[model samples]
Target chain A: MSRTRVQHFSISLDGFGTGEGLSRQAPFGHAGERLHAWMFATRFGKTMFGQQGGTSGVDDAILSTFAVGIGAEIMGSNKFGYPGWHENKDWTGWWGANPPFHTPVFVMTQHKRAPLELEGGTVFHFTDAPPADVLAMAREAAGGRDVRIGGGVRILRAFLKERLIDHMHLVQVPILLGRGVRLWDGLEGLEQVFDIETTASSSGVTHLMFARKGG
Target chain B: MSRTRVQHFSISLDGFGTGEGLSRQAPFGHAGERLHAWMFATRFGKTMFGQQGGTSGVDDAILSTFAVGIGAEIMGSNKFGYPGWHENKDWTGWWGANPPFHTPVFVMTQHKRAPLELEGGTVFHFTDAPPADVLAMAREAAGGRDVRIGGGVRILRAFLKERLIDHMHLVQVPILLGRGVRLWDGLEGLEQVFDIETTASSSGVTHLMFARKGG
Candidate 1:
């Protein structure tokens, strides 16, 4: 029974997951990592960048669960690379030679490509299939463990709309990204199916955890 | 030196202050009392209804400040009365003989009407003045005390767009209204002028407090 989960997803106060004007140079566009600055200040976020001395508070505790009991990851094309990265066959990913995901990573895109095996047991599986097909593939690849939805907002919203997500954690940063890719659009009355719990940290970000009811 | 403040204003997680289809029967429309239900569970809200025994924790402590240091109040027409309420001349307001507000209340509306004085010190004065003019009038009526911006979202958004609000405290309810009057629209980059603080109560509502810098 592998659960589908979305972890450590950050959004602005105005519900934007990533800012507008995204490019190769500015991955998050004008957002400039502000949405995830809180996580960066946490112990887990610091360890990701090979840094030290971060807070071990609520943020750190929750963010540390990113790698817990997970086997495979499914990410959107936007998160895999910038606009038109599929055209350039050389584009492996934003992550260097050895990516953090030490498992089979499925990139949901219309353009299919050969599975590129990277260091640290990470393999990129590009697929043109829909969510259910991708989920099934990811689940099989995950063995008996859970599958993570590594998103850039659009993919997360699509999964949420289809009721494919089991557990979701959204970190709400306290900044107004006036223009960006919104997360809450079209997913109205989401509380009907999920139980939402809100917790605020001293570092100024609010964690909204949503668990599917009776799942 | 009276400061313009907005206190205890509740909005849904999706940013809707009030739901659609407003009428005399359902003041908040589809939203009903869900947004203010947390406040009602507080000691201050219980005391308002002449009841006793309610939570006096963070929610109560913060809600108890709704009337602190306020002289006069300014609100939108939507908050004053339901749509087409002006057609019925006898209609005073949603609140009965003795309204909650005990200050000289200024109702911003296009329709001009004579002053309607209710029980206690609450007097309804209808005016079509803009945000600045209404603030000046409310300030004058407030004397040396602070003036509160009692909103239904539209008026508050107007005042916020004009940057006339000195302090604002918004309670974000967990429920998603889906559709209604939104609070955050057109007022982008608001954080540049106001410093925001967030606190979550045990009753499952997040309080967002914004104070203008150097005001």
Candidate 2:
């Protein structure tokens, strides 16, 4: 069975997945890169950024699972690029030419664009379909492997609210980003649906894994 | 030097200190005892309720610090009892005649009530003074010992907003109490003033320690 999973997602102590006032210049707005700082310190993150030498502890180990059985990814347009990215026709993505997602990357957007086949087998498929339909499409495209829910807070919250997520790994950073898009706003009584496990890393970040009950 | 500390404070993953619709019947509202379940499983919590034989790991170790070097406690009236607890004049507290505190416990309330000295040196003093004034009174009552900021969300937030808290220990429970009194509201950029450390316990609860800088 192909699981719909959310991996390596990060949120602040106050529950903000991304800070307020997101823009092209500030991808995470006032939050900046603070949420992903823990990931960047990991060996996986360092390798992803074409660097070397990072921690090989629990944080690194968890982040390294990004490609495990993941054949397709569904991400929100906001995550694919900055706001008003549709206006820029030349914008491929934040990645230069070869993106990290070596899978069928589904970008949920109202502005349809031709599928851009990038290097390393990463194909950006722009779609305006709803979560379930997109999931179906992604799952079919996945071809037996699992589907990954690439998020920018809004997308993940939608999937979670709809109970479409089968498994999730959230990194809870200690910093309190006072304002931003909250991931847990309407997610009340979440414990009833998911079996949760928490682990603290050496770098002072708590990793929470949520597995859907009986999924 | 005397420090104002908050110990054994529990909050939901969504940052709710206590659930909504609080009443006498439901002390923590819909959240019930879920937030403090981790603590209840600890030896400290079990012994506090006159029980025995519980886990004595990191969670227990942190909970056992409920009375370390504390001489006085300032808590909101909401924590003293439930909503409209003042209507019931004979109410001493929830903790029978023997209560837990072996020191002066100031109950912050608009209604004035005479001090009730219970068993085990626990005295409940009702005060309507502001946070600083109450802190001053509690500091004097502490007798050079560290003063504890006992919270029910509102009081702790007030002291925190005033930058009067010297240290705080927050247990982040995995459960999500959708609606309730939030703790992290308006407390943005708190990391700038305090150094935070995160540790995950065997009980699946993450312990967050915030030590005020230069305190």
Candidate 3:
């Protein structure tokens, strides 16, 4: 009964998961922190970053479930670091020494690197294998628990195209990012496979949850 | 203080306003009545089509605003009829004898045609003009009342690009039309000009309302 899930993924009104021109200095490019402002304002988000004083409403309620019942994570290389992260061997990640994901983290990339064991019980494993192969590895590492598919849009779309996602939660921010990596491009008619539900938060973001039917 | 507004314009979760392959046989193309099913379930929608016994909740409350406020309407030729409608001289419109729009409905198209006045005070005027010029005509016909910018996606986006819309209400339906005319194309950073708000109905549709900041 181990399921693959995606939680708290934010997208712009135009369906862009992240803005264009991502770099080391600007991890989200022109998007900055706009796409994640809602999460940052949540109590769960504040606590995750070792901060204090944040709202504990519906936004927080959803953000709190991000790490629940999920062992291990499969993230795209872009989510691991900026573009061309392979060139820099010293690039630990956007998160400092103490990372959030305490489980085994699998970073999907074409370039291979030795496994990195960071502080706070987080271990980074680099691989160039396809989605199904990577999922299989992550599922085994999950130890009979659900596997979380951490995304940077491309990898999420790939797993979704293969119908590997059991439960997906997408937070639709109201801002219109005219150009960027769109999340809904090729995944047309997705409602046919998933029973989608939407909840609008007071902070001007819509939470869309898609659960695979008969999964 | 008359303004131009769009209300109860339904689109898929993927931002598609209308599906592909629109013809006389299928008005909404592959989408059929799926996109507007939420509206049709509303009491206001049932009354519009001369039916009865429908829900009168938030969906009805929103759908009722489609015909509220002042005067004339501006719609794309595609909204008026199928493609190549100019070739058919007898093609009055998809709406039978008495169309829903009782005001002067201006149809924007490159091929000009004579004004076709139908029953119930619905006069169809064809003109090939820019957004401002067409707005001028519609405004004049509106007679100091607010003008409603009816859309088929393209015209709505054109008016939005020109920053002429004072208020816009878009209903995000749960269905996903894989292929269709998108409503949010080329409309980057639209949140800068408008104050946006969202409300999710129990019927699984989200209503997004945008009002011009200063207007």
Q: Pairs clashing in candidate 2?
A: none
The better-scoring model by DockQ among 2 and 3 is 2
What is the per-residue lDDT of model 3 for residues A9-51, given as tens digits with 9 covering 90 to 100? 9999989999999999988889999999999998999998889
- Residue B146, model 3, lDDT: 89
Output the lDDT of residue A215, model 1: 87
The CAPRI category of model 2 is: high
Off by over 4 Å in 2: none
Question: On a 0 to 100 scale, what is the lDDT of residue B43 in model 1?
Answer: 90
Q: In order, what lDDT does every prediction score?
A: 0.91, 0.92, 0.92
Residue B168, candidate 3: Cα error in Å is: 0.3
Model 2 chain A worst lDDT run, 10 consecutive residues: A198-207
The C-alpha stretches of model 1 lying farther than 4 A from their native spots are none
Evaluated at residue A73, the lDDT of candidate 3 is: 98
Candidates sorted on DockQ, descending: 2, 3, 1
lDDT of 3: 0.92
lDDT of 1 by residue, A123-145 (tens): 99999898989999999999989
